[model samples]
Target: MNSNFSLPNQKSKAILERYASSMSTSNAVSFPMVISHGEGCWLTDVDGNKYLDMMAGIAVNTTGYAHPAVVKAVQEQAAKVQHLCFAVFASEPQVALAERLKKHVGQDYRVFFGNSGTEGIEAAMKLARYHTKRPYFIAFTGSFHGRSMGALSLTASVSKYRKGFGNLVPGVFHAPYPQPYKYPRTAEMVLEHLEFLFKHTTPPEEVAGIFVEPIQGEGGYIVPPAGFMQDLRSICDKHGILLVADEVQTGVGRTGQFLASEFDNVQPDIVVLAKGLASGYPISAVMFKEHISTWGAGAHGTTFGGNPVSSAAALATLDILENGAMENARVQGEYLLGRMRALQARVPQLGDVRGRGLMIGLEFVKDPVSKLEHPELRDRVQQLGLEHGLILLGAGSHAIRLAPPLVLTTEDAKYAADTLEKIILEAASH
Candidate 1:
């Protein structure tokens, strides 16, 4: 190898071209630039262009990129020892991180580590079924659990992800998520829908679990009607069905509180977490209540579930979240939402503004027909936003989802929102 050789171009466009030629196209649409670095709530492109990251790597970087504490912890852990088969020889980082998670989650809880959100869901589902001795599970529409076989079976994002994969792990039924902004239904109505499904479609007794998102993340950030979650909890209790909260995207203080369910005063039997748990580190866990802690322990495992390096990063990340990062997320998120609502007053395409904390969405719709999607306008706004040094994302079908990092300051939120408004105005004018 030549020691002094240099590459010709480092721009994002060139990198993308190479990526398209060499990588599998099924992964995802590539952004123009290959991101070189991130800090706080900003990302730097290979071309040295900086972007105010409104999406926070799809709601994964809570402490933001390269937080000093997380970096230091990872470095120290890596230098000491990195790899250990958790099943045979457990490490200190794993034990400490588990204890910390258990402390924050609840006293009567146990943790199961995995490498991603889907793995957590898989473990939770298996535990629910094994403990209850039941086969079926009740999931919700407009939900996204993960892309794995078991998790994908619960996801109802679109036919594209499920096509040709029919006859899945049978007995997964979907209930309409109580999206008040779009459905405009009361809590009572939502409960009625669930009751109807149970009575007509599937028996509640047969359902081992009722999986839900505390605040529907991929479902356009649809916050359930007040008391809807409590009602679901009651139903699950009455029917002996476990409640599994899919907090993969909304957990780790993305929703102001440590967990989104905290605001509703509702607790779940099992909670799945990922995304922001270790900042950007690949780590996830299925936190279960005490009663089902030892349900078939050897039945499930992962090779890199709780690697020491990721655990160290997670421990440091949790410290940041508990100290003051969650409060910052709450304050900045509220400020951003207020500004977005103000902008909505002027932009006719802004159909709705809804979310809690940093998990927010601005749904775009045609002026008269609210159900119709304006993806073209959404695409234009996203492109215009990038040109203005901001990044945005579209979720569900017709919403601009804003899931900025928890470390984003008030000023950063305002600037991102201002740039968004400008892009929307420019798109509307065109």
Candidate 2:
């Protein structure tokens, strides 16, 4: 391990023990750094060790940590007022944020604010059912909408997430998402299966909407074959079903595009935005086509939705993304992808490298010929790389996702790629 790399601190260990025994009912998993602050793409621990932030707080810090623009916006907004419920009264930050979003939406759309991606999903669910007056929804296998009751009912990634939480929200049906690599299911085949499901399991007339991620995030950063999203749009159009694009992880320049769904040829009726939308602020937007925003007052509401501070932060995030961060994602993302693919020649265990822009996934395998997943090796590589000042995150069981900030420079990209290659080789040898 490097000298700057963190070792297990007794102070942090004691704090963690006390946290576990005294803290809340929710469980949390964290590395042992005990981070004190973040700047740009680096994190500083309380003990003064520094580490590159490769995952961007799980793709939340789109403009990087403690971004000056976002911090300034927050400070300015907080100085005036922090909490003026938008539902009760109009606020400039929230109104401006909504208007700014309108310009980017490219179509007539209405915005609804909430605190997180799950809230956006929940709102989308209600809107879909209310608009279509239907009883069923269609989701895909390996999809992770969220952990909330409604979103959890739609999620089907890991059995552990659903275990012990039965009797979930009903009317959600699951279909297979095209893996392209694993089991090699073509888009047509997946759509055919969906048709079979509609014919036998649930009628199309009864389905309120079909929710899909443009690029599967928790399902291992899987990118569907070309024309897959267009086909989905066609299917939904034919059935009068709303197509909800869950862009929680892929939105706000993560995919080198405003919305990964836009990478497809069609427009979704509803688009869910979170994660990178407000830098690190807790805010989410459920954007819907004007025609689909049919519900009247008292239908759905959130107290913390469109908080002034969060809205200000979101506005700053948008300014950064639109001005240059988005283009940077495109260039740096291509650089990172090409470099990783180049490494595959020597690192034969690198099975598949895929993604758009910054949301890249590198899958590890036992060997080139066998192509069996090597999750254990992947875990070892991540831990060792973290100890070497390179941070990495896993997707699915065998893949590592590089969802870095849009501001990531070529030097940072090179360092992370080199460290990852070295770590992978070390893990393979072990």
Q: Which candidate gets the maximum TM-score versus the true structure?
A: 2
* Prediction 2 TM-score vs. true: 0.97
Clashing pairs in 2: none
Worst 10 residues of 2 by lDDT: 1-10
Q: Give all TM-scores, in the order shown.
A: 0.95, 0.97
> Model-by-model lDDT, in order?
0.85, 0.88
How do the residues 1-430 of candidate 1 rate in per-residue lDDT, one tens digit apiece?
A: 1111122336866767777788775666625667899887889889888889989889998888888999999999999998897877799999999899888788788888999999999999999998999989988889999878889899987778888887778889887887776667777886888899888988999899999998888778888877777898999999999999999998989989888888778889999999999988999989999997666647888888898999999999999988999998899889988998998889878878888999998887777355467777877887787777888877887788899889998889889887887889888777
Candidate 1 local lDDT, residue 70 = 90
Candidate 1 Cα RMSD (Å): 4.2
The residue ranges of model 1 lying beyond 4 angstroms of the native Cα positions read 1-10, 368-371
